[model samples]
Structure formats: C-alpha cells, structure tokens
Target: MKDADFSDLLLIRKGEKDLTLGGGDSALAPVVSIGEWEARKEALKELYMLTLGQAPYHDIDPDLEIISEEDCGAYLRRKLMYNTGADERISAYMLLPKGLKGKVPAVLCIHPTTSMGKEQTIGNDPSSNGHDRAYALHLVEQGFITFAFDLMSAGERCFSGLKDFDTAPFYEKYPKWSSRGKDLWDVSQALDVVQSMPEVDAEKIGSIGHSQGGGITIHAMAVEPRIKAGVSSCGEWPMRISKNPFNAARTGWWVGRPLLRPFCVTGKEFPVQMHELLAMAAPNAIMNISALNDCKYTVEEKEFTGEAFRNMEENARKIYQLYGRPEAFKSITHLNGHSFLKEQRKAAYEFLKQHLFK
Candidate 1:
C-alpha cells in the first residue's frame, strides 16, 4: 500500500519481553451469562471441533492444490493448485519472501470479503480491495515469513461462498458434500502445511486477517496453539449481537448445533462471549483493528471486542504480571467504517512489530 501512512504510529523496536501469562486489565472477571450462567462447556468444545474437520491434514491428497507461480517484489509467489470439489479448487496466491533466510517467524494472511489470493496482499494490485495496505505482504517485507491461503468458498476455495465452497464430485454422490463450514477444517490443514515447512519458525508463528479472514484467524488461533499471536482486522472480536456475515458463519452453526447449543447457546444470557474465549489466548500478543466509517463495523461490535479483550487482560494478570504487559490485548479503531483505512493498517503493522518481532 504505497499510500499507507505510518507517520502517526509510535514505532518502537521489540525489546521488553512480556512472558507473564494470564489476568490483567486486558482480562475480565469471569461472569455467568445474564441468561445462562452455568453456560455450556460445549461452546468452547465445539470451537475445538469447529476449527478442524474430518479431513485429515496428514493425507497424501490435497483438496486445494497450487496452480501457478510468480515473482512479486522480494517474494516467490505460488498460485494454489486446489479443488475442494464444491467448485474449482480455491484460487489463491501464496507469497514467500526472499528475506526469510531460514526457519523464519511466519504469519498467515486472511482476506476480507473478496476471494483469497489477492494481488493487493503485497500492495501492488489496484483492482481488488484497494487499501494500499497489505498486511501479509507487509509482514514479509518486515523480515517475518508469512503464509496466505484461500479458504473454501473464497478465492481458490470456490467461486461460490461456503454454501458451495468445495466441488469434489463425491459431494455429488454424497449429502452436503461442500459446507463452507468445513472450510475451517481446510484452514486447519493449511496450518499443517505451514507447520511442516522447514523454513517456518513453527514456535513463533502468527495469523492475521481482515474482516472475514479476521473471523477465521480468531477461531484458528484460539484452537491452535502453534500460532503464538493473532491479529483481527475489521474482524469482530467483540461478538456483537449484530448479524455479521462472520458471526452467523456456517461454522458457527455447525459448531453450535446439537453439540454446543442449548447447553452453550444460553439465548438470553451468555456464560461468555467469543471475546472471552479469545481472552484465553492471553500472554500471546493480540491486536484488533477496527474502522469507524466501515458501516458494517459498529460501535456495539467493537464494544464486544474491546470489553472482552479488557476482560482477558485481567484474566492474564492473575498468573503472570511481568509481561504484565496488560496492554497486549488492545484495540484501535479508525474513524472510517467497515474497511481497513490507511491508519488502521498502520496500527496493525506497529502491533505486529512490537509483539512478534520482540
């Protein structure tokens, strides 16, 4: 994003390490939901089930495959050769930066509303979600290796959204062969690939996404410990009561149905919100990016994210106080709406540099 403005960010090199874990201003006091205090355990349990699917990550065959390769900037780009069978394989562009000399700290880039594999991820493309900001690509330029894959129903996942994310003919012979809900499982598999890579520093890994990608990143980070940090851009971490496409995601239905509902759904009350669950990811660096003009992003929406983050920081401080870096769980909002404006992206970059690099 050539037009991106980093002038406002208080840039600081990573120096102090906050190893302290659990409870601080970032955390909230555990509370029972107004409607259902007992709260069902299955919600989180379902979350565990939600991020993964029956699709085995160790299998020889891959639903999403790489189709092409290119060189952009200082990174090696590979087009994902993938076909989940719901449609064609998800069309995605993977970038491997030249600066990443060896087992490098890695990050996963998730896109907003459009398909995955955006040429703009690195900031050169103009046709796609033109923000002049590419978090995935920006991270690579910063010296940390990163991964960006198309989710089912997105980019290479399929032209269709989750309803038809995969196109395997077997789905033709089967029932609900392609539920984008299973895409999270697809992401889980993607993690396996990232983890398996010899050049990726598996221990210092992270995931960052915008909007829709933000939703997935939060879920993935919560369930997968391999990711040490998570950044949600224009993503709703607060779990507002609004009907966000991200909140009503098929994955939510899939996980909450039968298994997490009734017990965890506490309709009138919530034992905890999605943010509370995320708080469990304390001590791990976290940054939430929100835009004001992006109409889809609301005050209520951010409140949920902010309150939850605040609560989590409190939870984190109870155990470890040195990293007492209670400020880790934080949020920054742009006056603009639903979209990630220039300032928003800059905040994200600064946050990552502070935590991941440090």
Candidate 2:
C-alpha cells in the first residue's frame, strides 16, 4: 500500500523473473542407483565445461627446467619452469622428501590470492606472517611430495606491473576466453607435472588449498579426475553466487562478475546446480571445511551458506553412497572465521593421508 511496500513488490517480481530465465529447474532429481548417478555426473560435468568456456591448449612434453634447488632439511625444493600451453609458461616449486626411494603420494598445493602467491605456500616468503602458514612445507614434513604453482595474475604471472590484478584487460584482449577455464586448465596441467615426477606416486595425487586456493581445489576435483583426494578450506560454496552477488563479485574477480545475473544477460544460471558439481566428483575422497563465523559472509549469510553446503553434501553423499563408499565425502565446520587453522589443517592432512596413503 505504501511506497516502500510497492518497491519491495517490484524487487520480488524482478527476482522471480530472473530466476525463471536462469532456468530455475533444480539439479536435485532423485537418483535410485549408481548407474543413474553416473549418468547424472556425466551430464553435469559436460554442462560445467560449457559454463566455464574453453580452456587453453596444453603441451605436457615441455622440458621442465629446474632453475634452482635448495635443501630444506626434511625435503628438497626444486624451483622449476615449464610451458603449460603454447605461450603459458608456469613457474612452480616441487618438494621431494630426502630419501623417498619409490614413488610417493603427491599434493598439488594451490596458493591463495596473495602477492607472494606460490612462495607463501612453499615456505619461501617471509612477509606472509602467520596467516599464510606454509601448508605445502607441512605436507612435505608429513612424507608426501608436493607441487605449489603460481596461478595466473599472481606471483610471477602478475606481469602487468599493476598493484592489483585486473582481468578486464584479459577479457578485452580475448573476448571468448573464460578466466575460470584458463585456471582450471592450468591446474589440471599441473597434475601432469606431478605425474611426470619420478618420485611421485601419480595415482595417489591430491590437492589442498585455502580461500581462492580452496575454491580451485573443489573446481579441480569436479573437472580433473587426476586429483584422487581434495581438501577445500573456506572456499567458494556452490550456491552462494546466485543469492549473494556482493561476495561473488568480491571473490570472483572480473570474469566472475558476470555470474551475478541481471548484471550480465549471458550470466544466467549454471546449466547444473552447484550440488551437481559435488556429485560429479563422485567416488573420489573430498573434504570441505567451513567456518561458522567467517568474516567474509555475515552471520545471517553464513547460516545460508552453511545450509547450502550441507544440502550439497547431502545430495552428493547420495552419489557417494551409490558407489558404496559414503565416507568418500566428508565436511567439517569450526567457529573460527575464514581460515585454514591448525586443527582444520590437521584434519585435511589426515584426510589425504587416509585416502591416498592408508
């Protein structure tokens, strides 16, 4: 009846119409058995690939040149550079235990969005303080070989000399390219590097990451089967984007901007719901760590985020159960804000150890 009430009505109507255009069709169709789950997973995987756009080309035979090597007591760190595509050269650090005779389990330690990037994860950066504790070094201490690589626009790849990464330039230069696709391809190729190592047990390779690093861990698991196990700490939750545009834009960067509907016409709903992505990772061991009072999302928002993750876990577990390995999917939540704290870190390590080593 009043002006405020009329405005609310308009907002609600707009939201409803947008949802319809985004294909409000739910991804949570009932699955009766493993065969049905398998078909669903295949369909979801195909849709996800389409949503992410095309990934760059890969050349796995590039000569990985080790430019420097250092002995870090528990492990040997070798800094290496190689080409992932025709023009995409990657710089990464490989940590190998001192006396690993046979092939050992390996982890692709993805780095968070930091200026130091891979150095922070590999324990070579002193400026990170306590926030960016070297988790990759910890993995090496736990007797697993590890590889930490710089994501695009981070570490050495931030070649623009700008203070912050601006993906707008990239999109302008290559209109059809997807940032998420390029990143997915890059990390997938990193798996190739892990498998190529003589000391790495390729079949037992896993990945762990914090924040954006954690977000990629989930994405990598859904798309990259080479990752046998994965741990995502305070990463992006599947259903957060459509509802929370602010957080999505804050975390997603330029390319992620379009995911907020009405902002970009093409950025409607994903062909499959976020839960389906988890389902796509079926049979593989995956662990999601959530923080109850994360600073990123408000208290009310966290409640929704937590519920979304729980729902995803529930639906994804159906697929895992169909495989007769329900324990493959696990989730943990703590009161601490967004972080991969000591207790959380330990749980991730034990998870990987259990699945990949035990």
Candidate 3:
C-alpha cells in the first residue's frame, strides 16, 4: 500500500495540546511537576503502545525448555527456548557464572541489527571481530548471569535463506500487530524467564543493547518495570527531529506501523516523540550512549550528532529530576561513528554493575 493510503487515525488518545516535544525549549506542553508527570506517565506509555500496535496476550505460561548446555570456563552456557505466546517460542542463551554461592544479578543482553542475533552477544560470531560485541560473555565473566535472545527478525528467528530482516511473514501472520509490539512483548517475557530462574535474583535484573537493540532497551525499560537498570548504546533519536522521520529504513515500514505514514506525508508533528518515551523510564536507572558521528544516508541524509543526543537527554532528564532521582538518568557521548567499541562497552558494563550490583 502506498504511504498516502495508510490510515490517518490519531495514534495517541490524548489531544496534541497536552503533549510536549520535551527538552527545555520545545514549544509543546512541558511537564512541570512530579504530580503532573505521574498522571502523564501511563498516558505516554499508552501512546507508545498505540504506535507499536496491539500487544500479544501475556497470560500464557512460558513453558521453559532447555535445548543444550556447554561449559565455557568462567560460565556455563545453556541454549534454551520458551513460550512468549500461545504459539510463539523464542530462542535464547542463558549464561550462568560458575561457582555461584547465592542468587546473582542477571542482565538481558540484546544484540544490534545483525543476523547473528544472540550469537553476537555471546561472542560466538566470528564476524563480530572480537569481544566487543560479545557483551553477554563479558557480563557473565563479570559474575552477572546473562540472558541473550534472538529478536523476531534476527538470528535464529529470521526467515530461512534471508540474510536481512524480513517482516513479511510477521505481518502476514499478525496483520494487526506491529513488529515493535512483538519485540516489546518478547522482551518482557524474557524477563519473566530470568525471574523464574533459581540462580538469579529476580529484583536485580537489567538490560543492555547496541543499535537496534539499544532502541529496544529504551522501549522495554519504559514499559517493563522489571528492568531495574538499562544501557542503550547509540540506539535512538527524536523522530520529529529526524531528517526522514518515516522512511522505510528509519521508523516507517520497518516498524510495521502504517499509522505514521500520514504524519510523514503531511509533515505533521508526531503526537509522541523519543524524548517523551525516554522520560517514561524515570526513577529507573537508564544510561544513553551516543556517538557524535552516527550518521546515515540510506533513506535520507541525516546525522545523529552529539548535539541531538544531548537535546533528547536534557528533555528526559527533567522528568527524572522531578522524581528526585536525577542521578538515575545518565548519558555519555563519544566521537565514534555508529559503532560501540571497547571503551563504550566498559562504561556500559560499569553503569549496569553500579546499579544492579551495588
């Protein structure tokens, strides 16, 4: 269907006047007090859920099944699968640190936009160069039980013979549900699996991701309260400020949400923006890692410079401060271009450790 043919129904239930673009200087309605923020948090989550489409039923039990186990020196890696819905099951790797004396902190490791999926997070992908992308392995070595899983369109979950993300089958099966919704649900279920484990401290769970995984990290933390702390590396930017906000490769067709097409075509302001989404994670520890040169011209020439990251951070910080937990929200920027290297990985790990362990 052409972009213009998509429905123009308002994605958010609240009127546009009540919403703000975030940041100190935005023209939209700014959240001023903690009471105001408390009333708006649920609405903002509902608005984001509207953009993502219908969520899957969560009442079904995750029938956990173990497929295999391997000894990896510092940790034991177990390949497993569990039900996220009545019919849907997702593959994951659960890394448990050896010689555990008691229940330990756990982290959900999310991979970037690679076909390697959970494999890259565990250092099993040769194409990942080194241990930089193997953050799950790194975390396990640091004594945190780590769970890494394949997103719907990546790794083992990708369609056979497809090297890149394929959303056709997903849309065909769940015509009304968006891929983003499925992802968010899967993440929440993954947390359920982690909390069920006897070796894990249920209350100490956190999440970390890079690129696409990073964006999912923010979304998951906003809606999934089980995620006590989160680290997102170069994962997001304000959609309204993006050059091609609704292009296919950006947040348009890939997200499987056609409702955004009307706004893109008419150049209308989005009722919901990324900064508002970030604010929804208030009181919970969240660290945003951005790169100054993370630019891309695939759909349209646009650069996610450090300046843009700071603007979004500044806006989200206002909400965290209102909660009296200003230090819970942290951000860092590097000169690297669209990449998460060793230095950034160390900082992310340190942040997660401080919040989850200390």
Candidate 4:
C-alpha cells in the first residue's frame, strides 16, 4: 500500500520575491502554478491565486448537538454551528418556508465584521444600510430557507456594547468567560443542526456571509462538507500580507490590537489562507463579490485585492473542474467597494438555484 504521508510527494520551494507570481509586488497578484513545484508550494500557489486560505488548523473533536431553541417561527434553531470546539455556543438562526411540510434547501449565514466579545451582535445591525437581514428575508420570500444570527461578538452576546444580552444573567453569574471560543462553537453546532434535519436536504446546504461573517464562512466551509456554496463579501483579505481587511498578517482585524507575527502563532504553526478555505467548497459553486472602490483600503490596494481574490476564484474552479465541473465556482466585481451589492445577491440566488434546486 502507498504510504499516507505525502512527505516524499512534494516540497515547499522558496522563490525570490522578484520571481513572485506575475512578478507583481502586490500580495493580491496571481501567479501561474508552475507544475514542477512541490505539493504544498503548488497548493500555496493555487491558494494565492484564489485569495482565500485553508483552515487555520483542523481539530479532531467530534461533532456534537448541544443546543436547541424552539422559540422561532422562523428557522429551526440549533447549535452544532461550530463543527470544532474551537468556538462555543455559536447561536444560529434557521429560517424555513412558512408553509413548508417537508424537505427544503438551506443556507448557513456567516458574519464577517465582528468585535472583541459577544457573538450575537450581528443580528441587530439589520437597520444599517448594508445589513444582511434583507437578503435573509429575501431568501425566505423566494421559497428558500436561511439561518442568520449573531456570530461570537456582534449581536446579543456583545462585548463592547453590541448584542442583545440579558444582563440579569450577567449579574447573577458574576464573571462571564466568553469572547474566546464563541464564534467557532456556533459554527460547529450549526453544522450538526444542518446535518440532522430531515426537512433540510443535507446535500444542498450552503453558506453566505459578509465582512467578519464572510471570513467565518470561509473558515466554516474549509472544515465542513455540508456547505454547498459560499458568497464572501469584504472578508477577502486573508491572503494579503499587507494592511487592512482581515489581513491579520499586518495589523490584525482588531485595529490597535497587537498584530500576529507568524512566529508568534503557537510556535510558527501556519494558518491556511482564505482561498484554501474557499477551496474546501470544491465541487460546489462559490461566488466571490468585491468592488474596486472599496473605501476600507487605498485605491491602488483595492485593485490588487481584486486581482488576488480572482486568483483564488479561478483556482477553486480549477480544482472543482478536476471533479469535471468547471462551472462550480465563480467571482464577480462591482464598481463600488466593501459592501455587498444587489447584483451579487441576484447572482448568488441564481447559483443556488442552479446547484441546489436543480
């Protein structure tokens, strides 16, 4: 039998900076994957092209269904949201068809922009101009089901005055030990819910997220097999070793917070890129949306970011194409910046309709 270890299968070659992909100085630029490279290096080249990364790390913890709330007339509420125990009790919202009697399609909604603590704060911002509720509600209206809720630190469990928490419990329990493991927890727990439901077609479940949620979506898909498709917004900054967005490699998502030096990450254990995370969705359709004028970063940098994410998009297609379906992945651009656009939404629904409903 062939040894499982791929050590002899490939090596990580370090090329000069000037020999970078496309010879572009911008981290977002793409490079041709010279087939002669080693396995990880080839994977890295493919990952760099897509602009997303593989999982930061994979956990061995088994999936467990630990929470279920029956209060919503909306989604079937549950918490196997976080597949791994890295995060905890990540509250999830499952919106099903109003008059549904049986199985239906479902989408796991992820929130990209988040704060220090309190995972549920994402739900309230629906009143904001770019809030995701409109899309979630729109999904409901389209005879589809969606689950949208606060991630670790945004909505009800908020850290810096964000979520809709019941402070009475805080006063009753004293020190609340959260903030650290809430995000990943919700994702795994939600995964359990998706897999266990008879009304949900396990093969058709998908995910869509913006900002911090988008980043989480990338992470979730990297580790979960149920996610059939993903639409990522501005959280496409993981691959760039520069400033702004989720490129924690530079300034970290929490501005002013200490930046993460590669060496400082648990004795140099490398985290996967966002593109690699996207690749975990192989054989599934993915739509990456970005705008050239996003104000989050400087103008020139935005273009570079776009090119980099496109590399990820194309690479994902290449992999899925190996499964013999080149149309399983895609990328789109808007003239605007940072925010998810209507066109992207339209395209997303269409992709879902094609892959899931068809």
In candidate 2, clashing pairs total 0
What is candidate 1's local distance difference test score?
A: 0.54
TM-score of every candidate: 0.65, 0.84, 0.86, 0.64
Residue-level lDDT of model 3, residues 234-273, one tens digit each, is: 8886565566766422342255465666777888866666
Candidate 1 lDDT, tens digit per residue, 1-358?
Answer: 0121211111112222441343333422333332221122334545556433333323433555557777776777766655433433445555677756567777778766664344456555566466544777777777777666655444544433343333343244433332333545556556666666677777777888887678667766655667778888766533333334233423432221122234334443233345544544555777766564353545655554444444544443332233355666766655556666667677777777677776
Is 1 or 3 the stronger prediction by lDDT? 3
TM-score of 3: 0.86
> Candidate 2: where are CA atoms >4 Å away?
1-29, 56-60, 127-132, 240-243, 246-254, 257-268, 300-305
In model 4, which regions exceed 4 Å deviation? 1-91, 112-133, 160-182, 244-260, 263-271, 299-306
Better structure of 1 and 4 per lDDT: 1
Clash pairs, candidate 3, are: 23-315
Whose lDDT is higher: candidate 1's or candidate 2's? 2
Winner on TM-score (2 vs 3) = 3
Question: Which residue runs does candidate 1 get wrong by more than 4 Å?
Answer: 1-69, 79-92, 116-125, 159-181, 240-266, 269-272, 292-327
Best by lDDT: 3
- How does residue 97 of candidate 4 score in lDDT? 66
Residue 67, candidate 4: C-alpha displacement in angstroms: 11
Clashes of each: 59, 0, 1, 63
Model 1 residue 353 distance off true place after TM-score fit, in angstroms: 2.4
